[model samples]
Target chain A: EADIYQTPRYLVIGTGKKITLECSQTMGHDKMYWYQQDPGMELHLIHYSYGVNSTEKGDLSSESTVSRIRTEHFPLTLESARPSHTSQYLCASSEKTGIPSEAFFGQGTRLTVV
Target chain B: DQQVKQNSPSLSVQEGRISILNCDYTNSMFDYFLWYKKYPAEGPTFLISISSIKDKNEDGRFTVFLNKSAKHLSLHIVPSQPGDSAVYFCAANFQGGSEKLVFGKGTKLTVNP
Candidate 1:
């Protein structure tokens, strides 16, 4: 089983509230990614990190920011939450060796900005 | 323009029957393809993968066939069980300096027991 974990399986917050979704993995993976998706919809990449101190925005535009100070942790933060931000956030990791290109995913965080 | 696309929104199959899910991609740079399974409110789980060098890959009870010429791929599951019901997503990775996975819209598979 993949050792990735995401906190607050479900969260409900008011608009303008700042919140952070925590993600961590026990495996020593060099690549990490964050994706946003609505129920039953396709996943849109929001942010990703190549390694510590390396972060980049993904295909989909997001009003969120992420930091990679530690290889095991990649957290996504919303400075000012909005109703439009309500969706599922998924965190994933992959080894840089590229042997197994498949990514291991966390259980995911379901956020509701009311 | 979406790089990856799963045209089927949902698929249904009876128990012990074969279930096939299809995906298409436009980017030739994507040499690595993967299939992921996800449950409601849960994250996607890696199911299987294939490289561009090969046209087919198989894991117990699951097989993925790739057609580079057509830019299409299909995942087949034999003896489908109710437990196999979940959302299936297709993703592609470009073998480059910054390797990342590009995902499709996803197809929900319902295995009726």
Candidate 2:
């Protein structure tokens, strides 16, 4: 089974508050990614990490930042969250083998800024 | 332009029937394709995947078909069940999983018992 996990399955906070979404995986994956999804929309990649201390912005622009201090942990932080940031945040990880491999995803954090 | 596209937003099928979901991609660089199933309030789960070298890959009730020339792929579910009601997202891996995955908008499948 996929061992990736995300904390705070659901969250509601006032605007201007800062928040951090936690993601971790026990599968020892070298690649981790953060994606944002809105209802009826596609999952958009916001941030990704190749390995420890290797972070890159994804195809979509995001206000949140991510840190990969350990291979098993990757966390996303949003500074001064706004109502526009209210959406579902998904974390995923996959093996870095050159061959094809499917990614494992976390339960996701549904963030709402009121 | 969206690299991957799922033209249909949703589809409804009856139990014990077949459900077909289609996807198309604009980038030929994508060498691996996958199908993901998601439910409400949960993250997506890997369903099945197909490599560019093969045209079809089957796993029990799920089968994924890839057409490299047309840049189209599809997922078929045999004997659909109510439990199969969920959103299906088509994803493509650039350069055979060496790069990030590109996802389509997703197609919601509703299977009535």
Candidate 3:
């Protein structure tokens, strides 16, 4: 089935270690987004890409960075992980048109920095 | 500051009863709104949506009501089922090209059987 996918559904790493979270979609969507969320809390958008090679920061200021090399892949990298970075990272994709365009989301990556 | 707000952190409803979830927004620029349902260890799934121009929209047992003047919206689920227990988030987006969404703190709904 065509859907968004995120690797490393669960991760536990020491603080200050470098880590990368992978996200890919098979629907060929032009718009993709990354969001950070705490359990039972609001989701905060951290990064987004309009298309391949076009990336932008979202409302939240994040230490992590993202790249859109191909239309299907948008990966996020954290140079130095911290305990505060322990949260769920969600990846989503959507079409450009339509009112309230529905976004398809991946299962999400739960990171634990200790 | 939180642009969207879901005041009730959690709610409980008995099975076969009506369950109402409310959301309020401060930004009038938002013209489109959506509701998403999320379960443990899974990403949120789109439930329903409504445009600012429309007052209500319905799909199956899910219905979304929007009140532009009050900058408020609500989701009503009739005859709540145990499977309906999950966290529901309300999100809003503007009409411009960016289309970035502002989301509210989710409300956890528990349907007791």
Clashing pairs in 2: none
TM-scores of the candidates are 0.97, 0.98, 0.97
CA error at residue B92 for candidate 1, angstroms: 0.6
**Candidate 1 stretches greater than 4 Å from native:** A98-100
lDDT of 2 at B56: 96
Q: Give the interface-residue alpha carbon RMSD of model 1.
A: 1.7
Evaluate model 1: give its TM-score: 0.97
User: What docking grade does candidate 2 earn?
Assistant: high
The alpha-carbon lDDT assigned to residue A20 of candidate 2 equals: 98
- The true-structure Cα RMSD of candidate 2 reads 1.1
Scored against the native two-chain complex, candidate 3 gets a DockQ of 0.70
The residue pairs in collision within model 1 are: none
The alpha-carbon lDDT assigned to residue A34 of candidate 1 equals 98
Share of true Cα-Cα contacts across chains kept by each model:
0.65, 0.74, 0.67
Q: Count backbone overlaps in model 2.
A: 0
